[model samples]
Structures are given as structure tokens and as C-alpha cells.
Target chain A: MTHTVLVTGVSRHIGARVASVLAADPEIGRVIGVDTAPPPSLSSDGGVPLGRTEFVRVDPRGPDIAKVISAADVDTVVHMSLVSAPPRSGGRALMKEQNVIGTMQLLGACQRSATVRRLVVRSTTAVYGSSPRDPAVFTEDAEPAEPPAHGYAKDACEVEGYVRGFTRRRRDVTVTTLRFANFMGPGVDSPLTRYFTQPVLPTALGFDPRLQFVHEDDAVEVLRRTATEDHPGTFNVAGDGVLLLSQCARRAGLVTVPVPSSAFQLMGELARGAGLVDFSPEQLRLMRHGRVVDTTALAAALGRRPAFSTATAFDDFLRARDIAGGLPAALMDLLTRAVAR
Target chain B: MSDVDRRVAELLALLRRRVTGEYEVDEFGFDPELTDKVLLELVRPLYRDWFRVETTGMEHVPADSGALVVANHSGTIPLDGLMLQVALHDHHPARRALRLLGADLVYRLPLLGHLARKSGHTLACREDADRLLRKGELVGVFPEGFKGVGKPFSERYRLQRFGRGGFVASAIRAQTPIVPCAIVGAEEIYPKIGDLRLLARALGLPYLPVTPLFPWLGPLGAVPLPSKWVIGFGEPVRTDEFDPADADDPMVVFHLTDQIREIIQQQLNELRLRRGHAFPPFF
Candidate 1:
């Protein structure tokens, strides 16, 4: 019983990699990579070529997406319709519209179509939001401290709510929502990576919040497993362990400038104007109070531990970017050598 | 290498581990290496010399198993918790680290929160408490919270009402024993004479304490009074006798909470008499 999989947001790196992975799977009969634009020189972080995945230039916001879903007899719809890169034209507002509306329209199609039974929506841990009052480790069932006021976190929140509603509409669909930690490693560009790679990283003043990172390869593998398998439920997918924001800086060799949180946002706006990094309210909130989610459920469902821990994933990121032996790392190495002798 | 050089190399190696971020913090962010090498080292002097903290019933605290150490919170500055850590780390035969459950305010600050986590302190939330207990780690809690810390000088030794008996429930859930801890000298360290509610509200603190030397002496006054402290650990109150399901039963939780509270109060009374003077004649 081979399956035809329809993957949305195929133009993006993660989406393209997911599509290509499915396309290469022997169990998958056909793979339809649907997005408004074609995938840009697509391949996974592991160099898994985007060879067999068929690209269908279709807007998920329009009815044509439903037509394509029906025509292809797609059995699994991998919905990762997210755009988190720096603002290009209309900024956050347009991205919000694209994310929420695209998700809504795609859900409508999935709910109506008989062929669509499996739904894998790529969500984020950002939905949990950051705060001093929240739990140290959030299990999947834990309620968020408070819904995010605005930014991509809010958008992810709304998108997840839609995903929940989709579950009710189509009871037969095996819905798997993965709230992934910030993805890191080479062959990827994210806000966290951008911030770390910058000559000087600006941090929230007086805070050295604990952080977690999921390697891009691990993320891709988990996405692939969830999409192909029958695991039905929202699971927090993150590498084991945690890192401090300051440790990340020391490892990345970036000088950190501490800005008061009130003034931090203003500094963010200034950086945005200079085309350095776009810092949303949610991101700033994370810098102030970092999030750490429990991945016990994921481990139970997947039947294995992630290959990379948080520390190792960070090390991979530094190595891939050729950022080995940063400030503290180099200094520590020298001290260790002299002492060892 | 000479003996001095060998020791220097060992110290430098530890420094390298810390500087290179080679240390591991538990899931709760308790850096054992840092806690043992740095935090406890800093607090030991105060515990031994300044507080001159004497211990009783060290035999009651389990050698290697998970147990909740419930204590009375005092000292206007809340140094009792640190002293408690030093007591367990230095006095206990196994030198086990106490993973403290802190108030939300401890985590709301900047460097304070970072240090709290590194020292194995977390917000006194039910989930974290239960998690630590399940991991078989010793957890310390000051159930009195701010009320115990902020009480006026007149009401110094009296214990405040425990907050809904959360620590008791956590102990039950973990099916571990609760070691009732009583610290006698903490209440006298900074005799809180007054509280300014307006300033407290403005600063978003629980209470703006006016100690005898605090405002009058400025920064110099912040130093705690050198009192002869006695930390007595009462016998372990076994929660394993009851079913773990009892954690949900409010009546059982209430009963256990009162029992533990009474044990600590009784211990405090006895220890207070034993110490005789806040600034002891022996000192």
C-alpha cells in the first residue's frame, strides 16, 4: 500500500527537505511538492538531493491547492507553511497573513478532501512563550503562560489552534503536530544562527537565560518519521540538555552587548534598520526568559533518543560555520594545554 | 612537577572545564561541579564562622535517597536557604546537594535567577518539585516564603502559615520522606523592625523591610548579625506509608502539612532554648 504525499511550503529549506525525503522513501509512491514558488536549489543538510519530488506551483491560499490535492490523490499532507526569515516586502503583517490564511485554506482543503488522511503540521515551541512564571519544562499538555501578544509566536499560536480545529473536523486524519526547538547547524539560516554569527550579539541585560537547540538534521529526521508513521498527537521535539545564552556566545566567538529589555526592542528596531537582525517581541521575550520543553513524549513515540544533544547540536553549528575555538573556547584550550603538561 | 605545581595544574584543569563549558547541568539546570567547587565554597565560611551553624540529627536526613527538607524561612535577606545548602553539603556524610525550590521572585530577576538555576534552585512549582523527587534528588523548600522572611521583629520566632501545603503534596507524590528542618538563629540575623508597603509596591517587592541597621547603616548595614545558629533536622516523616494517590486528597495533604509544621516548630523551640543567646556568649 504505497502512499502519495502532498507537502506544502516546499520552496523553504525544511519543507523542501521533508518533501525530498518522502520522495526517496520506497513506501511513498508519489511526492507532490506544492508551493507558490519553486524550491530554491533544494537539498537537505545531509545533501539528500531533491531529485524525485514533483514541484507544483500552487498557492495554498487559493482553491487551486484543493484541486491539486484531489487530482494527485494525496494521502498525506505535510503542512509546514511557515516563513520565519527576515522581512522582505510587507514585513511581519504580510507574513502573518501568509501563515494564518494559508494554514486556514489548506486545512479547509484537507478537511474536505477524502484522500487526505495524515496531517503533519510543523509548529514551534514559541507557542509556549517565555516568562518567569512558566514551568521549567513544559510537557505537551502544559498550558502556555499566556498567549503571545504579537509577532511570529502569535502567528504560530493561531496556526496551532487551526491545526487543533482541523483535528475535530476530520477525525480520521492522523494529526501529528511537532513543536520543534530553534533549529541549528549548517545548511540552515535562522534568527538564532543569524544572531550568533553576527560580529556582536545583543542580549537582554542582566539575563543569561537557559536555551535549547535542535540540530537541523535531527529536525528533518523527526519530521520524516512523524510524517511517514502513525504517531498522532502534538510532541515537543528537542535535543536533550540545555545551554545558557552566554555559553552560546562563548562558543560562537561573538561579543555580546547587553541591552536593557525596555531599550532592547528599540535596539532591535535600530538593528533592523541596519539590516542586521529582526528581533520580534517574542524573540526578545525568549532572550529575556528562555524556553525548555520536555521531549519525553517524543522519545516514547519515536522509540529512540535524538542523535545530537543540545550541547552537541550547538557544537555542530559552530563547527559547520567554521566558528571553532571562539573567545572562551580558545583561551580555555590554551590554559588546559599548559596545565596538562 | 612539584607538589604545588601539581595542585596548580589540577586547579587550572577545573578552570578549563568551566571556561570551555564542558560541565553538565541536570535537566533542572543544577550544575553539580559549580555548586560543589564554587557556590558551597562561598557559603561555607558564613555557615561555619559568621553563622557558626551547629547541626543536630544529621542521621535523620537520608544518606542517598530523595527526600524533601522542609524548613522555616527567615533572615530579612533570606540567607537561611544558602546556609541550609552549606549545612547539607558540608555536614552530611555523603555531601549531597540540596536542590532548593525558590519563589517566583527568585527567577524574575537577572543574574540572581541565573545563579539560582546553576545552584539547583527552581520556582516552587508542583511539576518541578515532582520532577526532582522522581529523579531521586534531595529537594529543600522554605514553605514560609515571604511571610516568614518579612515578619516584624516582635513576631520573630513565629512560623507563618504554609502556602496551601504544596510541599507536602509534592512529597506524597514522590512517595519520599519529609525531613522537618528548624533553623534557630536566622530570625535574629536581621530583626525586621518595620516594613514600608508604599516603597515595596513601587519596587515590586513582597515587602520593603526596615531592619535595625539596614536603612540607617546603608550598604554596610546589610551584613547579617553574627548569631550562633543551630540547624536541627528532625526525624524523617515517612510519606511512603501512605499511597502516592493520597497526594490528591486535600484532607491527607492538610494533615501531613500540619504534622511536618508541628515537628519543625517543636524543633525550633527546643533548638532556640539550646542556643540560649542569639549572639551567644561562646562566640
Candidate 2:
């Protein structure tokens, strides 16, 4: 029997990739992609159709999401929808309402629906607040810190709590929460990408914190595994290796300027306040701490190794951006992609 | 001033003198290590601005031995731990360094990994605890874990679950005495105005702790209010006296844990009564 799956936030980036991957699976007969935004234009690149996927333009935060999912007869729900960027002036409040309320509503839907048997919620490594980096790395059980900033993440965590709690009440529903590290690949527009794309990357003065990046493909694979596998509880989904931010930028051929840590912190605060950046002080703290999560649990659960390395991921990103040959290559690719689009 | 008041004042003055001059240079030393700098820079201003820290029970801490100093972990953050370390090293006659048994959360950060290791913090793992104790080090354990440190400001002084007497087990296994220490001021440092657990998890932090002034005021607000800190060490619970084989006995563990909790609670009550303030008084 073909299993129907519901994936939220499937209009863009990670969600879209997840949808495509799931749709390709023989076991997953149909995938209902939920997102607030309009679905991206799906077309054949190199005479190969991506896959068959259905787009549902409905706000996951709305009460109607459950109805929509129930109508679709989704057997599994992969909650990938979230406001990934830093909250705006009122973003935190919006995020809380959307993420927390949306999750509750979704959980309610799952409870009411007989078809929905398993749920996988996409979480971030941001849940683990900044700590002193350990060489041994953080396992799934690593307790979170009270982050000084990033209020939205806290709300998201509450959603996870509700989901986990819901599982205990209903023995039938199996839930898995994946706390992913910094993910980079095609279609990602994070601060790391911004730094790489910029002519001059701004770095904290006197500090080059270690960073972990999971390629988009690897991220999708982990998500795919989570959606299909029977693993329960939370796991830290990270890449195989670690790299410094400066190293990433240098490898990408981006120039870097050492900005005072205080200045950068101030800028970050201002950006968060202005809704220009999504990272909280706590997120910055983790970034400063250079998180290296232990991927043992994730690996054990997935039963496979992640495909991309930090070097290879960076190389792939450069190739995708057409910046492999350096400055000229980056400019040409940018112009060409712009023209093509 | 009365004689007792004069003596207490003189002792405080003498301790301050020792801390600033001989003690700081000799014991902890004016090392340019970041943790020391972080402790000095972050704490000193608050000390000058808001706190008049007084530390007692310096003698209970083993001068040179692998002793497990188990204390009730409170305060929004472990500001008490930082202060206690500073106070113990600077005030104690032996100037023993405290190797804190931090939670798994402390050892999870990237750059903080080195800092925590360098600052002598290990995972609250029994193996780590055993290793540190066997090495003749003073190990500090806050059995309360996150439950204690993340307590709401309203229930600030109230102790939380100490995790089934693991500290006692560790102490017994290592044959070290468990010192019950009470910190008076930490609860007020960053009186948790609110906690957002989901946000905490997203940032991969323990709790999304909001001080009354942080985030809104940025770094300036991050400055902890100098609440006059009083650290008191109670009599040690001798682990050597207990049968090591009885480590797995629930009754034995429960009694020890209860006894430790009572001692800490009593000290907290005493300090509160003596201080005569709803919150610790800033200078």
C-alpha cells in the first residue's frame, strides 16, 4: 500500500527538496506540500523531471491546516514549516503564534486523523544554546541552555515539547525531532551564504569560531530517513566535519574584514531588532562557541553516512554558484543565473 | 561600631585586602587567562556597583585533597559557581582550585569546549567525576542540575530535584566528603523574568532565559546586578563513613540526599533571615 505524506513549508528551500525526495520514493505514493507561499516553478533541468508533488498554499498556522491534511488523507506528517530567519520587530510574537499554535493545531489534526501515524518535526541545533565546545561533541540528550536571545527558537522548542508530550498520550503516534546544524546548499540564503557572496566578509575581530555545515542533499537525506525510519526522540543531525567561517569564506574566494566583536555584536542586535537577521544573542553565543554536535545517534538512527564533507559541500556550493574559478567565475555565474532567471 | 560589627567589618576589610593584594597575586594569580579575565572583568564591576560579597566556611574546603564539594545549584545562570570559585581560591588559606562538574550542556559548545576544559569543568559523568576525584582535585557538583539553576525567580531559593542522589554515589565511590554550600546572591543576579523553552532548544541552549533587562538592553542589560553575595559552607557529609557497597541502596542514597538538601535549605533560610532582604542587597 502506498503511504500518503504531508510536508509543511514545501514551497521553498529545504522543504521543497524534502518534498522532491519523498515524492521520488516508491513507498511514498503522494506528497502534499504545505506552505504559506506560492509553490516554486518546477521544471526539468537537463531533461529530467524532478518528481510528482502537489502544492497546497495554506498557512500551517491556520486552523484550516488540519482540515486540509485530513482531506488529503496524509498518513505521515513531516513538519518542516518554520520562519527560519530571525524575528522582526514583532517577528518573535508572530513566530510564537505560528510555530506554537500551528504545531498544536497540527498535532490536533494528527490526533483526529486516523491516517496520520508518524510525525517528524524539523528542529534546529539552535535548540542547544551556546556552551563551551567539547571535543566529545553533544549528543541528543545534551540539555539546552537558556539562550539570552532567539526567542523564536524557544517557542519552536515548546512545539517539540507538545509533540513529544502528545506521543506519550497517544501510544500509536511515533514522533521524531531532528535538530539540524547549519545547512548550506543550493537555494539556501543564510548568513554564511551572504558572507560568501559578499565582496568583503565581516568577521568578529580576533575570533574565528569553528562552524559545522551540512550540505542540503545530506540534510534532505537525513530528513528522508527520519520520515521513513521508526526512530523516536530527538537527534542532532549534523555534517561529517567542521570548518571555520573564515575558512569557508576564504575557500569561496571572498575577502574578509575583521570587525570588532563588540561592533559585530551590536550590529547583530540591531539587525535582529530591525528584522534583518534571524539569529538571537543565544544563537550568536552558539555560533561563537562553534557547535560540533555528535552525529553518533543520528548516524545510528539513519544507518548511513552523510555524503558531503565541509570541503566538498563548499566546493559544490561554489560550483552551483559558478564561482569555482574565483572572482571572475563568481561574477560571470551571478550574471548568467540572473539573466537565466 | 560594636565589637562584633567592628570585627566582622575588620575581617571583611582584611579579606578584601588579601583578595586585592596578596591573595589575588599568589593564589589565583593575575593570569591573563580568559576565564580569570571574564570572572574579574564581568564580576568586579558588579562587585563594586552592587555587591559587597562575603565568603565564610573557607576551612571546610579540603586544603589539598580530592574532595567533592556538592552544593545546591541555583541562580539563573551559574554566576554563583564563578563567584564561589573566585572566593574559594582567593579567600581559602590553601587557595585550592575548584574543578566544577558542569552539566552536559556546558561541554557542548564549539569554542566553549576549550574554555570549559581549561577552566576545569568536566561533564557531570560519573567517570569524569571519578577521574577528577582520584587525581586529588576538588570537584564541585550541583546535584540540582538545570532544575535548580533554571528555577523561576519567585521560587528562587527553593531547591529542585537533585537527580536521585548521584552526587552522593559519586562522593562515596570516590571516598570524598560532600560539602553543602549555600550561595546567597545568585538568584537575584539575573532574576529570570521569563523562560521560553522552545526558543532555548532552537538556539541549542538549556533555557531561553530572559533577564528583566537583557536583549532589550543588549550587552548593558547583560550586566548582572551586584547582589551582595554570601557564600557559607556547611559541615561535610563524610562519604568514607558510608559502606561503599551500599551505593546502590535507595534508602541509603535517599537519606543522604535528604540530609544534604536539609542542610542547604537551612543555610538558605539562615542567610535569608540574617540578610533581612527579599532580595540580596546591592551595594
Candidate 3:
């Protein structure tokens, strides 16, 4: 059992939920939430009781993270601070620093610490890279036919490389990397999320690749299990089954505007420029070819079955989206049914 | 309610149920509903009218348990896989949908790949085949692969080497019977005369066949020849007699594979003699 855990990226929704869940567990001795900013208060009616987690302000990219880890004498470290999108101001350079440089410093801190025995890093399936030549389902051991072209995917690839290096040096530490599919749930912000949230969804003409999603709750639960348990090695974390991109849009109640691949590329750039969207080129590639990861190891080796499948998670996200938009429960139900049909 | 309204309501019910809870889909992303709605519908016409496919020995396929359907793959554009899928669904007493193993190229094409999955086709991998068999689902294999599909017109109906007998090993491991399937009249559909090597490579295709009509008549030439098709399913080769450990024995796998190949090739010869001609009008 893990005692006195340090959870990074607590300012984010997933990190905060994980931190709170850990705090509520009677077996865990202490819960420390670390981020550059103060964590938002857990709502009054939240499942996990508030005020149990001790908040610490520390940037993972800086040297102070080491001090926090040493001072707390944390036995387990859950790194969830990896950014999925580029910052509005500094863009690529800033994202690289936050993801790559931040991971290096965090790993450096854990390497020097005598108390830390377990480390869990949040990664994405983007490392596999979408390509026409890729296999139908990529096993954990499959090499990327084409390396990540740019942005978060390339950075994620680099971050994983560094983590592997850390593993080689500190063979004693149990390193678990969870490569998640596109996260879809209430309050999760991602490029795909933004695309679907829009009233009109643009798709590449004549292309509808398979898509996968993991509910935010399942994503958080898997992280907690990894921190509390002792599963090692890399695992692909995605809910079962897949949906076509068109199916996703129809479920989301969005109007799909099919455009040629070249025109869609131009529109993506223009949309980003106009601040209407942040559609990255790599994401565009993903939309066209679609990406899916095999989750056999996640269940067989890691011993965790997700509560939701891809279609259910997506439906739940849509349910939440419709409800938040002020549709009554019954009408939302009817709308979901009608759209699904 | 009127008939249209009732259909609308039923449609709504289906959508609502699909959105509400988790139902089961196989590991390869098979969707029975969509398969019925789209893929089978598209193939039904070709299977029934265009090709006029006639199937025999349908009883050989087990009703309740898994069996491997190993067939000779032909036609430059391989419609044999789809035809077999329809035959199993329509002709067999069990009406079990055969999970046809497909090539990587099938998965590479965006729209084609999506439809293939919904239609219960998966990558021709050992892991998928093993899992499907263990689940007691009937699985189909076209071991001849691109070699049989892309062979020249002169080599029509000639059986190619089955790839290393991986399917036999999978069947042995799963303890499932292997049913040899032979598809006649598929070879003459495309009549592949030449291979456009440079164009095929540039297009990321396995091989671009230059049929007599193709490249001369443009897209119109690409239509299939509508040759009469016959599918024969041979008796199951029992793998239960061999210990599951024999799956690892390469020699056993090879011998079994060769035996299955001979069965299929012999069936093909018999089918030709029975039909009397490669293309018999309105037979």
C-alpha cells in the first residue's frame, strides 16, 4: 500500500480528482497536491471529502520540485502535469519545456530521492502516430511506422524516451507509463473536444477512420490504481471498441461539413488563426487516418477493466454536453436517441 | 403509428439503447448492426444476381462452435472474401457470420477499412484468429493472400503456397476444426493480364492489374465480368486429435497446411469438371 503520495498537476481536473480520491483512501497516510497554482476547492457535494490533501506550489520544470519530493518523503509520485495543447503565447517552445524539460526535472528528483519507489507517468496514444501504413491495431511492442510529425505527439515521444532512460538508470523504481486514447468526458479540454464542441464539425472528405475514447473518470481511476498498486511496464489505456469519426459527430449532435483534405488543412490553419479553434496539423492527420491502440495489456497485465466503453464514454460526454447547454433531461434523452438513429 | 413512424420510433429506440449502456463488440471492432445495414446490403446484390453464387456442403460448418474456413483467394480485386461472408450468412443453417481475415492493404484504405471492420473482417494476424476461435466464433482465412489474388490470367485457378501454415497452428491451439473451402469462377472475374509495377508502388497498392479492358476503357472497364461463382466447403479436418502442443511443431503445421491445400485444389479441379466450362452461360 502507498502512503504519503505526491500528485503533480493538481490544478487540472483529472489531477485534482486523483488527488482527492487518494486523500479519501484511509490506507494512504498523506496526500500532497503539487502545482504551480493553487488547486481549486473540491465542490461541496464531491464524493471525496475536502481539506485532506495538502497543497504545495511547485513547478515540475524547476529545481524546487526536488525539494518538495524530499521534504514530503513521498514513496509514490504520479506525474499528470503533461500539457496536451500548446500555450497561447509561447506556443511550441513553451510546450516542449513544460512536457520534456518538466519530465526530466521530475525524473531527476525521483532518481535522487531514497524514499520514492514508484513512479506513474500520464502519456497519450499520439506517440503511435497516425499513418496510412499502420496496422489495424497496434500492439504495445509495435514501432511507429512514421514518427510523430509535430506538436504534442513529437513532444510525447521525446518525453517517453526520457522516461525510458530514467528506467534504465534507476532499475529499482517501478515505472508505469499509461498511454491513453483521446479523453472524452465532462470538463475535459482537448483539440478533439474543441472540434466536437463546435456546432459544425469539419471532416476530411471520404475519410472516416476509427476513433477511441476513455472516460475522464476511468482515466482518473486508472491513475489512482497505478499509484496505489504495483503494475510496471508500459500499457495502452483505451476503452473497448471504436467509433467512426462520422459516428462521433452524429452522436455529439454536430453538423459535419465534409471538405477535401487539402481544403480541410487550409481551414484548420485559418480556424487556428482566427482563434475559432486550435486544430494542430498532427491532429488533422489523426482526423484523416484515425488512431486506435490495443488495450489487452491494460486488462491482462495491469488487472484493471475500465468502467466504460468507447461508445458509452462518448455518449456520457454528449449527455453532459447537452445537459450543460440547458436541455432538460428527457429532451436530451430524446435528442440523443434521434441523433443516434 | 404509420409504418414509417413505427420505423422511426424503432430507430430511435435502437439509437437510445446504443447510447445508453455498453454492449458487446468483438476485439476487432465488429458491429453486427452496421454490417447488416451497409456492408451485407452492398454485397447482397453482387452475391445473388451479379455473380449468382451457389454454395455446397454448407453443413460442414459447425453451428455452435468455432471452425476455420480456409479458402483459395482469387480475383485481382478479391470479391471472394465478401462472397464467402454472404454465403455463410445466407446459406448455412447456423447463419453464423464468418469473420474473414483481411490483408494490411484492406486496413490501410480509410473507408474500405472501416467498412471491413463493421463487416466482421480483421487483420490476418494469429492473435485475432486465436481469440475469435476461442470465443467459439467461426473464422475464415485466405492463406493464398496477394499471390493468388494478383496472379496472371494464364495462371488462373492455380493454387499458390499457403503462408507458413499459421492458420493451422491457430486451429490446433484453439482445438477447432479446419474446413477447407474452394471458390471457383473467381479467377476469371478480373482476368489480370499485366501488373503496373511503378503505378502500384506509387499508389501504395500491392499490385495494379492491367486487365484487357482496364486502362483502355477507363473506369468503365473496372466492372467485374459477372462470371458464375461456386463455393464448396470441404469436411472439417479434426485438430482435436493432435495435442495442443503440436501447434508449436513447424513440421506438423506444414504437413497439415499442405494437406488442406491439396483438398482445396482437388475440389477446384472437380468443380471445373462438373461445370464443364470456365464461363457457362446461364448455367
TM-score of each: 0.96, 0.55, 0.87
TM-score of chain B of each: 0.97, 0.81, 0.92
What's the lDDT for candidate 2? Answer: 0.71
Segments of candidate 3 deviating more than 4 angstroms: A40-50, A132-135, A138-144, A147-149, A273-275, A294-304, A323-341, B1-27, B195-204, B215-218, B240-250
In terms of TM-score, how similar is model 2 to the real structure?
0.55
Q: lDDT winner among the candidates?
A: 1
Sort every candidate by DockQ, greatest first: 1, 3, 2
User: Which rank order by TM-score, best down to worst?
Assistant: 1, 3, 2
List, residue by residue over A1-341, the lDDT tens digit for candidate 1: 44898888887777878887888899999998887776765233434367688888986667888888889898898888777643467787778877888899888888889888799999999989988888788889888767687778888889999999989888999999999999987766777887888778888888877888898889889989988889999999899999988777766666789988778888877877777787777888889888899999999999988999999999998898887655676677787686667
Off by over 4 Å in 1: A42-48, A326-341
Total backbone collisions, model 1: 0
lDDT for each residue of candidate 3 in A103-201, tens digit (9 for 90 to 100):
999999999999999999999899999876665577788787788978898888888999999999999999999999999887677788778788778
Best candidate according to TM-score: 1
Candidates' C-alpha lDDT: 0.85, 0.71, 0.84
lDDT string for model 2 (A141-247, tens) is 76644542456467667777888878987788778888888777766767556546656666666544556778888988888887887788888877676665545
Q: Return the TM-score for chain B, candidate 2.
A: 0.81
For model 1, name the residue pairs that clash.
none
